[model samples]
Target: MKSLIVNADDLGRSAGIDAGIARAHREGIVTSATLMTNGPGAEGGGAVARENPDLGVGVHLVLTYGRPLSDPATVPSLVEPDGGFPVKASAVIGRGRVRTDEVLREYRAQLERARELIGREPTHVDTHHWVQEEPGVFTAFLELARESGLAARPLNDAERERLRAAGVRTPDRYVREFQHPRAIDVAALLALLELIAAAGDGATELMCHPGEPDPELERTSAYAVARPVELATLTDPAVRAKVRELGFQPITYGDL
Candidate 1:
């Protein structure tokens, strides 16, 4: 039997985003969420998570365009002079402009802040824009997660071997299916399900960005109206019937 962990990212991005995430967890089939500590609706999301302890909460580590919780001076090397993390993290990853030690410090601070604000550290850490996959960045993230008692993104064969050597937990599931605004389609939804079915029978996590049908989402947030597909995937009797037919269990991050 296969166990699935479904997660919604960017939970604290906005009220619309927060409400959407909550509603999905309540009625629409979302099981877990990645909290954005510095997001606008962070406090509210944190409150909701506390209220609904069943909803698995994890850290959506941010290194992109958003205000940092820590003071710029406090995390000098992590943010731009304008006091925002880089919106385009890929551009500056190999530019030799950032100090790795300072980056690690800021990450630690962020982890601590998340624990303080949410009242607990995350069970897992996922990068924003997969920026942590960059050189040096992954090591920093791994080290922090190890220190904070959180898990990290899994790696390739050699790296996986190293993780085993270090006694780190490798993710059993991969969220290969994500709801990008541009990639929204019924076919994609079916493909996502197919991928989930194809993943080896073990703990698997499917991450998504499902939100309300709001034009403002496109204007303000990186999320699009993939809620239709996501909602459909959950509420559709056919999909629900399929879950039963396949005899799969939907778990959350905390369930891990």
Candidate 2:
């Protein structure tokens, strides 16, 4: 029994990204998405989610980039003076500048913002740049999940075990592309499917960033051009056929 979740991250970052996520869910093997409440296209992302109820939208709680959903004055330890979040994960978690209390408040704010924008609770919660994987931050985030009764995206065996022990929901297996531009590698994905099928017994997730190329995305991320290629790979019929051939069921976090 192998289930695969092709969950795209950075929804609401820009118009291009929003469109790409929507298309991937509608036309490709993508089953879910993690929406960024503080992103530039947040309102658009919420509207898109409402339009496509099957997408299984979740909150992409961010603390490492862009602006903060909580007032900057209120979360001073978490944001820069200018109100933007630090681009480096270390500045917040590693430096210990962001206190546990700040994380609790900001994370709840982001979750609430997501609910307000999406018009419903998210199916799950994950972080921008895997920020929740950091030491003190991870503990705080786990607590939030427990309190909210929301599933979380745990990337490794240890984290999975920790979450499960805490009575939280998560996938059984996690797949990440070691190569840069992970989402565009259809051949690699096909091979991965073969590998997972051979192993045979866990729910897994494949995280991706697929989007249309746009000036805003280019300015904000180094990942701009790779997005369109990723979009192409995800929407490719051959890739979907291969997924079916391998007998991997495409699912959302809701299905976990």
lDDT of each: 0.68, 0.84
For candidate 2, the TM-score is: 0.95
Query: Tens-digit lDDT track for model 2 on 37-113?
Result: 98768999999889998888999988987888777888888888788898987776557566778888989988998
The most accurate candidate by TM-score is 2
Give the lDDT of residue 248 in candidate 2.
86
Cand. 2 Cα-lDDT? 0.84
Model 2, stretches more than 4 Å misplaced? 178-183
Task: Give the TM-score of each candidate.
Answer: 0.86, 0.95
What's model 1's lDDT at 93?
72
User: Which run of 10 residues does model 1 get worst, by summed lDDT?
Assistant: 155-164
Q: After superposing candidate 1, which stretches have Cα over 4 Å from the reference?
A: 155-164, 181-187, 214-216, 227-229
